[model samples]
Target: MNAFMKVQNLHKIYGDKVVLNKINFDLKEGEFLSVLGPSGCGKTTLLKLLIGIESQTSGKILLKGNDISQLNSSKRNMGIVFQNYALFPNMTVLQNIEYALKFHETYKKDARKIALEVLEQVGLTEHMNKRVDRLSGGQQQRIAIARTLALKPDVILFDEPLSALDAANRLTMRQEIKRIQKEYHSTIIYITHDQEEAFTMSDRIMVMSEGHVEQLDTPLNIYNHPKNDFVNDFVVKHLQTKLNDLEKCMVKDYD
Candidate 1:
């Protein structure tokens, strides 16, 4: 079977500055892949291109073997959860999620059913009547996810969805996201600067540095053996704590 999605020779430029350079990768069906990088490394730019939020300067983005690089965001059948959760403050949680079905076929019959189903999946069934602004950050994020999943898109793009949350909220949202992904078996491309976040929840990680793909591999391999100097240095700081713990395990404490 072929990959569920393929990016070929992708490049994006802005005037004289290049933001993405000859990027390439394949995402398998139901795979959870995280794009990890520092700010301005083109991680968000890449996600934009993937979801058709921004047109690429050059290259092809193929979904299920058809070119979708030039397709409009709505026509791409891809869902995105923005960093801020992008919920409508004026709407209640159920209304926020049900809004995604407006133009969809499901809008005619039982839109409320689909919306409630997704709310239950995200553990927010009871809070459906509450306005999003009144909820905590983690709850808001779940509503964002419920809205996206209600559409049942072929692929999901998360653009630093937890970045705006506090440390506790971030941790809670992370586990919630992992649970939802596992339950739905959705193909997801998550973008984040947090190494622990990427390592904890991804099947594979694509490490980017200044518009280039430094490495693409499983989290364990990326942690134990980075592909290049950039990757090694990038992961070293995050790996130190794990390395120290392992070393301490070898030397039993006499307490």
Candidate 2:
């Protein structure tokens, strides 16, 4: 079966520099996957390419088997939540989310109503009237997510969405994200440099390095049985500790 979302031979270059070189990957429908790598590893560039924020030098990005490489960002229907939340500081929480719906001709008329429902989904109903600056980082991130969900896009791309939050809040949001993804049955591609974050939230983690894919597999397999030295050295050195931490976070969701 073909993947619900696919990237084939993706490459990006700027003058003399190559950012994403011959990249290839895919996502099954409703699957939550992460592209894990360190800073400057081209993960963010890959996100940009996938979303059409920047066109690839050469490659194909297909959504449901249709080539969407040439489509603009808005046409792709891939929503993104940036690390900084990207909320309009002047807008209220409700307004920030409703702003996204205004661009979708179908939802433009019902923007406010749909925004309220999505806010409730993210557990932010009470803060609906709050100014964007008044909310906490976690709350703001939820607003970003709510804004994205309001679009009802084909795929959601999270560009290191949790990296800006404090550790405790990051843990909380991790579980919340998993719950929300399940609730929406959404297909997602999460970009992160933190192995623990990727391992904690993803069904599978794609390890990347210097514009190359090192390995792609379940977290346990990538951690316990790394396919290469970079995978072992960069992602597997902690082993049991990450597993313990991962289990503890999952357990916290029920507590």
Hey, what RMSD does candidate 2 come out at? 3.9
Candidate 1 vs. true structure, TM-score: 0.93
Candidate that scores best on lDDT: 2
Candidate 2 lDDT for residue 153: 90
In candidate 1, what are the lDDT values of residues 1-255, reduced to their tens digit?
A: 888999999999999999999999999989999999999999999999999878999999999999998989989999999998888999999999888697687563778989988888888988999999999988998999989998889999999999999989999988998899989999999999988899989999999999999999999988888888888878766577777987788776733
For candidate 2, the 10 contiguous residues with the lowest summed lDDT are 234-243
Clashing pairs in 2: none
- All candidates' lDDT scores? 0.91, 0.92
Superposed model 2: Cα runs more than 4 Å off: 240-255
Error of 1 at 239 (Å): 2.2
Model 1 lDDT-worst window of ten: 102-111
